[model samples]
Target: MNLLDIEHLRVDLRSRERRGAPRTVIHDVSLTIAPGEAVGVVGESGSGKSMTVKAVMRLLPRRATVGGTLEFRGTSIPAMPGRDLARFRSQLVSMIYQDPRAHINPLRTIGDFLIEGVVASGQMNRAEALEAACTLLRDVGVNDPQRRLSQYPHQLSGGLLQRMMIVMALLPSPELVLADEPTTALDVTVQSEVMAILTEQIRERSVGLLFITHDLDLAAAVTDSLAVMHAGTVVERGPSADIYAAPRHPYTAALLASRPSPTSVARPVSIPGRPVSAFEAGEGCAFASRCPYAIGQCRTERPEPRTAGTRTVACHRSDELEAVLAEGVRA
Candidate 1:
């Protein structure tokens, strides 16, 4: 059964009064998480990847604003009021932000931080919260749960601190956890270790996971499904392995080519242009200017998602990209 569901979700960060008008950061996106499914939302910066997840968490900044339907466990979220939303936040969904340093209180002890996070969950009191904290610390692979909890955030290594934030989010045992770039700061080995800890911990529980990251390879390593965003729209999504092996959109194709991967035994081919800003637009497809095989139709008109072979691709000329994807299948 699906634990979290989102549909036709749209988020616009651009202000018409400013200059660029009606730039939808997250445009008409829909996603769902089954009871224990781990899904990855992958794309480069300004791809509207994080914003879609943030909208579900109700964590979007005031200035950005959110629109479209948001549902969790079959209920519409926008209809959920303030107090109920607050209550839902503690029990239903929890998010581990991209940066641990920003999330942690520099003044507070690590022990205090974890305790407060659990207490806020509304399911645990002081004593139980403390017990959960120690277990959580140990579960995150913290070597000295007791002695270390007393130390401040600065005292812990960057990896430990990042894992601590993960512990805080996981402690509640909420129905869903949205971890945004949880291992970005860690070294490769540490990244793998943290991923293992997260996988092991989150697996035992039936918690639905929305593991958000810009790393295609990292997402592939963990997620059951993948969503690739480009220029504020979800250009492609499917089974994680299938999306990597047969990315249907040009933008996803570029992302796969540019990323570091074992398949790329040769040097990685850099996708030529930088990612377009959320505030960017043109007369046609957002990526038309830079697409290698752009034809007049692509340049003149944008395309909607075309369904084929257990995948979704948003492009006017998906057949051409399909040929490229076909090569990946043979490899």
Candidate 2:
């Protein structure tokens, strides 16, 4: 069975403006992750990538109304009772936030944060959890594990803190890990190292991973498959190498063209306009205004997802766009 399965997931949050109606942030988004698979969700900021995963983790704000089926290991998430849900959150699934400092309590020692979940879940006693924490800390490359655990979050570097977060996520041996841009705040060198550790750990343990990031290159480098989201919906999805080499959607192609390449001397082309939120797009394709290949039909009609071999794309002009991308690759 797939480790995680989401279908037609829609989330609407109460607008911050008191007078406005609820605004939809996630629109009918759906994806699945198999056991031991690593799937990357990529998009520009505010494109609902984070919201999608937040929904999966059931961490959205109280004001947000969520609708859809979210299942993990053949069990429904939204319908899980309070105690079952608590166990689900603490043991079956884990989340690695983008900012470790924000998630970790500054006043608490690292040992407190690391062992809390295991102890709370009643999987291990305090002393046993501490011993396991030390082992995990060592596994993630921390030296003097006992000493480091005694130190507070403020004392550790960003990379080390992130590694610690990974250790916490793995402590319970979760079937799935939801990593929401866990390395974004770190420097490039640190980012690569952290990602390497995460990928290696997940692979060795046979855990599924849902990695959300705005950085397409990083997503491509680490994940087996990629889902490109836009305006609260997935615009394209496929194997990472296939999507990177030949993007089917105009937005996906634009994103690829915007990335700086070491070998390409030509100036990188930026997307013509800013992204539009889901509420801003009524009936038309959300990217119609910004899409270079958009036609009259694209301006008025929202396209449905269509599968072609190993990929899926929601674009009326995917056929033409595929040809264009193919030609560019040939050149």
Candidate 3:
């Protein structure tokens, strides 16, 4: 079953002005996830990656005007009202947001955090909630669960705080977990552990995961599918290996090249030119200015996303570029 289906997911953060103008944030973006599937949304900061999910979760502030079909478990999420919204967020779908320190309350104990944070939202009682919280901590690989329960957020390390948030999200046993950079600010070792715990927990519980992050490498490590967002648009998406091995879009290719490689003797190649914002698009392709393969057609008319051979590309000259890359590799 399709757990979540988001199409033409446009989110404009600006309100209809008291005068007459309006601004925008995210443009048309689409994606789907099957039950228990883990899909990663990757992009630079302010790319509308977070905003898009925020729209779906209905977590965006009142000023935003959103237009799109967000279906969760065959039901339209955007159309949900009153209790349905609350019910869906708590019992069906959950979000683990970025920044654990800021998220956690210094005044609250871990048990209090779990209740006010996760357990209190649903049907679990205080005793059951406490047990559930302990189990969740253990499940997320935090040792000495009982002792940790008495500790505040300030007492925990960065990695432990992150693990706590993940546990709380999973305690609800939600069908879909939208984790917004769940492993951020942790060391590489702790990052790996968090990923392992999350993947395992999601799989074991048969929960679909929407893992959002700026780290393409970490996303590749944890997800089966990759969706690359640039300046509020998904410029490229494909199977993780396929996209990593051969990114069809210039933005995707540039992102891959920007990462350091052990085999490389020099610093990583940087992708020149900044990405276009939601309200700031030129006449042609969004990536044309930065695309090395762009031609005159690219500068005049925007290209819709299309499948070329094996991968999808939104460039006017993608076929030629693909051929050139293929031939160069062969040589």
Best by TM-score: 2
Could you list the CA RMSD of all candidates, in the order they appear?
2.2, 1.3, 2.2
Candidate 1 Cα outliers beyond 4 Å, as residue runs: 14-23, 261-265, 328-331
Using lDDT as the measure, the top candidate is: 2
Question: lDDT at 258 for candidate 2?
Answer: 84
Candidate 2 lDDT over residue span 100-122, tens digit each: 98899999999999999999889
Error of 1 at 108 (Å): 1.0
lDDT of each: 0.79, 0.90, 0.80
Order of the predicted models by lDDT, top scorer first: 2, 3, 1
**Model 2 poorest 10 in a row by lDDT:** 322-331
Please provide, for model 1 over 1-331, each residue's C-alpha lDDT reduced to its tens digit, 9 standing for 90 to 100.
5787776687876564767555567765767788889999887887887788778877777666677678887777778888888877877787887778878999999888887855765688988888888888877778878887789998887778888888888878788889888888677778888888887778878678899899998898888998887777777878999877777787877777776666557667687878886567566787888888789988778787777877777888887668876564444
CA lDDT for candidate 3: 0.80
Q: What are the per-residue Cα lDDT tens digits for candidate 3 across 111-162?
A: 7887664554657878888898888887777899999999998998888888
Residue 206 CA displacement from its true place in model 2, Å? 0.9
